[model samples]
Target: MTFPIRTPDDLHIEKRDLKFGRDDAPPRWWHSNDPGRTAFFNALSSTFPVGEKFFMTAVRHYRDGTAEPLRSQIDDFLYQESMHSREHVVFNRQAQDAGFDIASAEDRARRTIAWAKRRSPIQQLAGTCALEHFTATLAHDALANPEHLGGASNEARRMWQWHAIEEIEHKAVAFDTYLHATRTMTPFRRWLKRSVVMILTSLRFHYVIFRNTADLLRQDGRNDWATWKGLLAWLYGRKGLMRAMGLSIFTYIKPGFHPWEIDDRSLLKDALRLLEAGKPKEMAA
Candidate 1:
């Protein structure tokens, strides 16, 4: 059954929880005290530049009228992504305050965004939908793993956990929007396009992670052997990061595949609590 697309009300950025970045507020994942885990998280943090660019590109695509239902999704997507960017910026600064060279890290992030922008719009959007699927799976795994983020401080873990929950929440919106917008494409062709995009984007993400990790290792005075080991461990751990990502990508080919279809609804209760606690005025349908 086709879900009726609804146009959400205009977003009020003013109503968002801006208190997230204040000085007295707790540090997010990027600034946690555990040196070993913090290094890992800082490396992971490098991925957000690409994430933000993807969402911004989606916002632009929807605003241009290429996707009908996505037009409404764009507002919430943009708002949430803007908040993500802001939080990460603050987190990056906190990392710098703790002695890392954030300026260099940010420079790399800017270069990556430029690369994403140079790709064709359709390619960019498809890559984003694939990444969204990857994140949806990662979010689920993260919520499941008892020690997934064991060393993080309470505030840091809370922030990342909150972000993960929301990522799962809207995971399918982009893919569904893309499907609706490109009505002429055959289902088989769409799946093929999605698979190709997923492979290419994963390679790009891996390249970024490799480069960023090398940079971090250089700054931290770590030997190449140790750094490489850490990278390998992250990918090959029991959770099988890349394998899970591939499985998530494959799920797109299944009939009725959607973010909510695989979701653990209990996690969503937390999101609902946050929404009600903030109580931002809801727009009339």
Candidate 2:
């Protein structure tokens, strides 16, 4: 299928108005207004800086003529990801203001960037594709598990939900670009490398979570039991986050799977219509 990449005409990235503890936003079940939530936010905050670097990397790759079709999407992708990183950074600041130490989280993120830089360009591209797939699965899970996320304030939920929808919307762009750039790679090798990257990256991410959670718990005078229980509960929740991730990964095995193919375009159309409608300011907000 020919993927005609189109950039949205009206993409804005204003700084969001979000307060940390004073906001009406309730924490996620895993966070439960606990110290763990702070840790989670801190970890998430680290993504923005990494995202900026990734954006530059995409631009560099695009300029080098690696993937012509995706060249059209590069500017849009950069805009979207830049905004995502900014909002997440704001969210992280809120968590820090609410008592989460974010220094270590930043350090971990820097280390991740350093590691990525060490890889060859093709390896880095493959890694990017794998990470994109991982994020797509996460976006789906976030939207599906409203119960877990429902406690967040209306505005916060809307922000996250919008982000999730867009993540799904652009899911295949990077993968398709990678395929086009690296056509010589055998399918078996591509799948194998993707699987390996997923396993390794997941482990690294979980390790950061574990460390951050432990730090938060210790600071709050909570024992290991509380931290372990929260983590376990999140993993074993009814929505089965891990299971969804595994299932989503299998989409790579399908020969012609693309994000646009799986996405509910009608929902996107409806959202666009709503966005275009002249609703009351508060109601839309």
The candidate scoring highest on TM-score is: 1
**Considering every candidate listed, which one attains the maximal lDDT?**
1
Q: TM-scores of the models, in the given order?
A: 0.77, 0.76
- Give the Cα error of residue 181 in candidate 2, in Å: 1.6
Q: Which ten residues in a row have the lowest lDDT in candidate 2?
A: 12-21
Error of 1 at 242 (Å): 4.8
After aligning candidate 2 to the native by TM-score, how far in Å is the CA of 269 from where it should be? 6.0
Let me know the TM-score candidate 1 reaches against the reference structure.
0.77
Task: Write model 2 residue lDDT over 226-265, tens digit each, in one string.
Answer: 6667755665566755556656666754655555555545
